[model samples]
Target: MVRTPLTPEERRRGERLGALLREARGGRSMIEIAASAGISAETLRKIETGRAPTPAFFTVAALAGALGLSMDEILTRCAPEPDAVPLAG
Candidate 1:
């Protein structure tokens, strides 16, 4: 199936998610975190680097569990700024 291209906002949101994950992963090795999350280090690295921004739901859940982050917090943190106006398509 062909995937639709991501909008710039989506890219920025992904970057924000990556940053949050990296911050939550402090003091832990990527291998350790990945193993705990039941994912490969490379996959974790990709997510953390925004190379694989749009990860699957389960993958995100696992990562959140591993990092002790709540989905609600993730949603809140990754949301676009309240004052930022959306561009007309």
Candidate 2:
């Protein structure tokens, strides 16, 4: 089945994820990171610039692992909120 095009919110979240990764990857070479993330340098470059909004799961998993970001943190950060809710005890 064909996947629907990403909604505006999804696109924005992807942009957010890209931004976070870019900031966390400061001083690191794109080629190195992308290879470690099991993706192409071009793919990583596009994602970093928000040109590639929707990347594959495994690709994200690799990058997230390398970046020390949990999936929950990525999702929470990518989404906009008036105030962030701290995890409950």
Candidate 3:
């Protein structure tokens, strides 16, 4: 099956995630963070620069873990709306 490209919103999400990681990684070198995240320095650089927007889920998860960012925080930060009502239970 053919694969569709990521939407603009998804790309923005990736950029937001990258910014968060950079903030969390303050005072740390890219190599150190990449090593801790189990990814190559170039991969981390791409992600951090939004060059690899919409990176694989596993990659995001690993980076989040290494950067010490909680899922809730990432979601809240990357989400477009902060006050959108949730669906009724």
The order by descending TM-score is: 1, 3, 2
In the range 1-89, model 3's lDDT, one tens digit per residue, is 99688887878887987898889899999999999989999999998898887778788778888889887887788776455688999
The C-alpha lDDT values of all candidates are 0.92, 0.83, 0.84
Q: Model 3: C-alpha RMSD to truth? A: 4.7
The most accurate candidate by lDDT is: 1
**Order of the predicted models by lDDT, top scorer first:** 1, 3, 2
The TM-scores, one per candidate, come to 0.89, 0.77, 0.78
**Deviation in Å, model 1, residue 18 alpha carbon:** 0.5
Query: For model 2, how does the per-residue alpha-carbon lDDT over 1-89 read when each residue is reduced to its tens digit?
Result: 99798877778878998999898788888888887887889999888888888888878889998777898877778866455678999
Better of 2 and 3 by lDDT: 3
Clashing residue pairs in candidate 3 are none
lDDT of 1 by residue, 1-89 (tens): 99999988788888999999999999999999999999999999998899988888899899999999999999999987577688999
Q: lDDT of candidate 1 vs native?
A: 0.92
